[model samples]
Target: MNVVSKIEAAAPAAAVEAPAERMRRVVAVAVEHGDAVDREGRFPAETVEALKRERLLSVAIPAEYGGEGLGTAAVADLIAQLAQACGSSAMIYAMHQIKTSSFVMHGTGSEWHRAYMRRIAAEQLLMASATTEAGIGGNLRNSICAIEVEDGRFRLTKEAIVISYGNYADAILATARRAPDAASSDQIMVVIPNDANRTIDRTVVWDTLGMRGTCSDGFHLEAVGNAAQIFPKPFSEIAAQSMLASSHIYWAATWFGIAADAFNRAQAFVKAAARKQTDGTLPPGALRLAEAAAKLQEMKGHLMAAIHRFDAAQVDAARGDDAALSSIGFAAEINALKVAASEKAGEVVRIALLVNGILGYKNGTPFSVGRHLRDTASAPVMISNDRILSNTATLLLMSRFDTSLGG
Candidate 1:
């Protein structure tokens, strides 16, 4: 069976109601400014503003720290909603959430962290993640960037390839290698002020097939003060569990938004064309459009169900690396959903092209489908499907070996 069919056959029960109105506002802002952002390669300032105004940025912050303290499932729902509207905005938004989560989880008690997070909670400040480097890539275990202890303080410098919202963000959450012998993982997560000797090369621009508004540009690092840095946990421990799980969940949720929006658009297109247009006195390509729409709905259900499972695991069980690894199952499920949605994006665009003909490709048509299609298509590659699958296989093999040895 196809991914959609598998999802339909074993759909998990629903858990919570997503903030539909809030999500709709995000979509409206994205769609409204999408073209301008695309035309000028500008950041989606309005969309980001809408999210901040809605206080959606604080979805993950704990209540004790002046945040809503919602769980992963809710945050995922919001991200998926945002993705459906604008992939670039969603990506930017996703990075912001990652930065925010990193701060809250790691920098909670520090005065600098606490002050920064307070501004974030109040929507007065924005944070972006800058972990993915150019030559070194995003390997958490191995990175050339270093933080050396100097005169009882850490001196840090690192290159970051694409820091989303780099231009507008108040802070950046970065990951680098510690003094080699200092830790087992060699990784360290730190927050840096956006203007901390961080010079933007401005050589790279996000001129891809989709998500044109993310403004995820490349940058060069310079010697900067380490006074603003905070380590929530040791690099090895975060790598072994929390960081990976958090990233996967947030990213997976955002892609679902892209899929969901494509599906909704396809559904509306099909319904309208079915009633208004007919080739040879019958609706042409109506059945294909219907199929695509159905698949999208099925995909949404699967995505939500997978999230529910993860939420349950978090709420009712012992939590640790083992518990966090359980999220990989959800990760796989998300991968399948993304695949389904991405493929469906092409199909829906085709259907839209067929149904609306030249109008679909016209200047102001809402059917400007190229953007999300490109963005979603690029997502799997950026995330490294092969790596995730390989890791899953390794984990499975290790579990089986442990079982056989009666451990």
Candidate 2:
């Protein structure tokens, strides 16, 4: 059988049991179909459709919402594995998870909450995140979108860009400036149906060195007014809710998976070539490549340990105290992992390129590592290394003091 066919065949087997396993299966199918979809610039319709049928896309909903209800660790693992195979698919999945977090934070008490979750569970109601904006970026403090309350109703309008699935999502979770007088960062989130009269300008095209399949095209919203199922709470509450229970962990997993993929591909190539070049001579290049693999493995271990700590801290928070420690710790570890993973992936790609030489550049060769290298390169930029380290240091410094923020 061909490589794609082999990947397709492995999916169902992987998904036979748990929700996470099912997500893994979904990812396998996405990867199997990735090359063709990317070639045509088409969405992974078949893979996404399969996820709907298998209930993989709805796995994050609360159990009461007719879903499997997986947690952060499981979610992260699934995204990472999918990303390792198809970064575009993984990005799409990450958008969905982010939307789900927003829903839980803001839509839980709305009249449409249960119905929306039910529909998501039963149908291929694709989800996307309309977070990033034009010049202002995704900063909550300076959002350009606004909600004007009028006679017991809310009118929402936004001008956003680069929505992960903006081209074709059944629903979009959008952030807008809340009505003035609402508390800090008071950004409001709403679920807008794709058909809601929103104008998509297809503004800035997604032309990147990696994640080419994400199709993160630009779009604009021109006074698309829905009865704004007002999230039934203050905007500050929603902001805190999202920050407390976010899907940041899952994206971290994707980065780790990309790193792992690079390491695995390079290792396989090196081992095979080593056997072929056994003219009783061990070259320094081969030795250095082996050392890099070892370092990559260490990074993998650190990532896994971080996942464990994050999960445990989440459990602890659910039982009693808040997950402030876990959140800060995970952020710190993720920063370290981002650097380690990105650097190692690049190193592995370089090694593979050097070791495979002409064969590495060949289209159909197993040693082709260019795409993986590019994909891994995005990790560092995704979550700024300086920002995370600074946050961690600030948190640690504050912990040592007994003083309050305000007198």
State TM-scores per candidate.
0.79, 0.80
| lDDT computed for candidate 2 | 0.64
lDDT of each: 0.63, 0.64
lDDT (Cα, 0-100) at 78 in candidate 2: 78
**Model number with the top lDDT:** 2
After TM-score superposition, what is the CA distance of residue 387 in candidate 1 from its true location, in Å? Answer: 3.0
Q: Across residues 1-407, which tens digit of lDDT does each residue of candidate 1 receive?
A: 85334422432211132345566777899878877786677888898777755556766787665566777767777777777767778777777776675665556657777776666665436777767777766555566777776664566666777776677887777777777565424677776776655555554666666666777777775535555564756665554434565665566666666655655555566666668865645465567666766756665565566566555655543333355434444445444554544455455445545654554555566655555556666665665666656656765555432223220
Give the lDDT of residue 74 in candidate 2: 75
Off by over 4 Å in 1: 1-23, 109-112, 180-185, 195-203, 226-228, 277-282, 316-358, 361-363, 400-407
lDDT of 2 at 273: 64
Mind giving the per-residue lDDT tens digits that candidate 2 earns over 1-407? 85334544654554367866666667778867876665556677777676665667767787687566777667767777787777777767776876776565456567687678877765547788665677676454356666777766566656676677677788776766776565436676666776655556676777776776777777776535555455565544554434323444555566667656656666676677668775778643577667766766775676666566555655665576545433544455554555665566566556666765666666556766666667666766654556556655776765553244331
